[model samples]
Target: MIENNRIKYSLAGFFMGVAELIPGISGATVAVIFKIYPNLMTILSKLRIKHLSFSLSSLSKKFQFDLLLPLIFSMIAAIILCSKAINFLLNNYEENFLTFLGCLMIILSLQIINFFKGILHQKKLFIFIFLGTSIGFILGQLDVESENISIFYLILSGVLAFSFFLIPGISGSSMLVVLGIYSPIIGAIANFNFDILIPFALGCLISLLLLPRLILSIYSSYEQSLLYLFSGLIASSGLLLL
Candidate 1:
């Protein structure tokens, strides 16, 4: 029984990683499809010192973090491994790439719409959407100026990406595109250029370490606000493709 479960967990991780590699697909969506979204989010949001210790002890006896940990790590690895190939395809096949991006963005927009339906009537909701849209548009227009990878920018990217990871319908890859690091960063990884990837990896590690605790605090006290902010971010990100 335990062995079967481990196989399933690994398979889930592989698929989730593939989904995450695609520009518009959400890792959370993959988790949802695999019937692990709620559990994953719960673990992510509630992770802290006490919970970590408990989870670690549980893992010593059994494959506790089995599915979630493998899934996340695999997804990250896949993204790094696949970045160059994806970029090559995108560059060589502009029409196909744009079409794929268009479809993905449309699906993402629908997801955002569904999310907003629950709070559509809120007086400030439109304002949030507008803000998100404006920001997304502006970000899309910004040019990538720096080719050199820096620790500060890498950390900033990780913080932004990690924050978006908690929100439904947001794509971390799309966030990378907006920040102008998507192509170069992916290229660095695809070619095994650690000079560029190392700092980004470090930033991602720090963000992952800190994110769970931050999520717990927000979920405990400011669920509504956090949801609004996330929704806005998603909406804006979707608008960027337009």
Candidate 2:
């Protein structure tokens, strides 16, 4: 049973990783689709990166290695293997690709609403959904681009981009684009620029250390409202692509 679960999680991670590489899709969306969002949130929220020891025994005791290890490996493999094909598709057939993605996202949002079965008050639900949709549309309208990026901006980019990844519908790459740091970061990756990478990586670490816990806390306190918000945001993301 454990082995089977490991395989299942590994596959989930691979798909999530690949989805994140796409412009409109968030990895969290894939996590939701795979029914692993709760588990993913729980594990991430309790992450203890500062307490790491070099020993394998301590590592196993400190972390849920069975799940984490498979996710890490599978996601890494997917990023390494699938990026080029995704890029090719995006470059050549962006409209078609985004259309498909938009449809998928909207469908997922409807399913989430259906799951609630009208438990929420209509007015409150509509408000949350509208708020989320507005944010999504605003994000889609942004097209900031930059040539000169400072360490501070790099760090901020790292933090915001990673934070977006944790959100159900927001695209981390889109956040990067909004911050005008996406191109620079991509250039850094392609050219192996440590100056750009170190700060960005630090930002990601900061988000990992802080954002997950905060998200989990908010989610626990407002699961129903947040779900409505996320459903709306995801639907808007799809609309943007369309």
Candidate 3:
């Protein structure tokens, strides 16, 4: 039973890893499809520096390392092994690839919207969904100079990337596109350019530390509403791709 569960987690992580590297793909979507999204969020929100203990046993008791370990390792493996292939697909078959994903997103978004029929009538709820759509649409449309980019922006890029990664229906890569630092980020990955990536890495770390609790709070209160908003965000992303 334990091994089977680990296998499930590993598979989820592997697919999420692939999605994580792709610019438009949301890892959370993969998690949701695999039926691991709730568990993932719960484990993540439980993760806090305050929860860790100096004792190994106590620490292990606090976190689901059994689930986390295999998932993390598998994700790392997928990223390392599939990076080139993903880049190849993005470079050569972006339109076709995104078309399939776009259709999937549209279907999922429509399903979510259909669930909350009342959301259509409520001005405040509609506002949330519209705001989400606007964010995705506007962010996707943005273009800025990437040359001589500042460290501050690099850090900001990383923060945005990780934060969006936490959010459903949004990919951090899309956020990088907004900053015009997507190329630099990809280049940094290929070249291991610490100068460019370190600040960004720092931002990711900080986001990891901070966002989970806040995400948990908002999600706890407005789970359906957030899903409503995310559905719109994802639909917009899908439309942009199509």
Q: Sort by lDDT, best first: what order? A: 2, 3, 1
Q: Model 3, 140-225: lDDT tens per residue? A: 88887778989998888889899888887878887887788888888998899999989999999888888877887887798778
Task: Supply the global lDDT for candidate 3.
Answer: 0.82
Candidate 2 structure quality by residue, lDDT tens digits, 1-242: 98988888899899888988877788887777777777788788777757678898777656668987898899999999999998898899988988888898899987876735664546668888888899899888987766788899889889999998999887798788778777788899999999999999999999998888888888889877888888888999999888
Cα deviation of 52, candidate 3, in Å:
2.7
Better lDDT candidate (2, 3): 2
> What does candidate 3 score on TM?
0.86
Which residue pairs clash within candidate 3? none
List candidate 3 segments past 4 Å from native: 1-4, 111-127
Candidates' lDDT values, in order? 0.61, 0.84, 0.82
lDDT of 1 by residue, 1-242 (tens): 86775666566667667656665455654454455544566666554455545456675334356656666677677767777887687779866775666566555544634554655667665565566556555655666565775779987887776655554445577568767798887798779988778777777777777776666566557555544554455445444443
Worst 10 residues of 2 by lDDT: 115-124
Q: Each candidate: RMSD to true structure?
A: 5.0, 2.1, 2.7
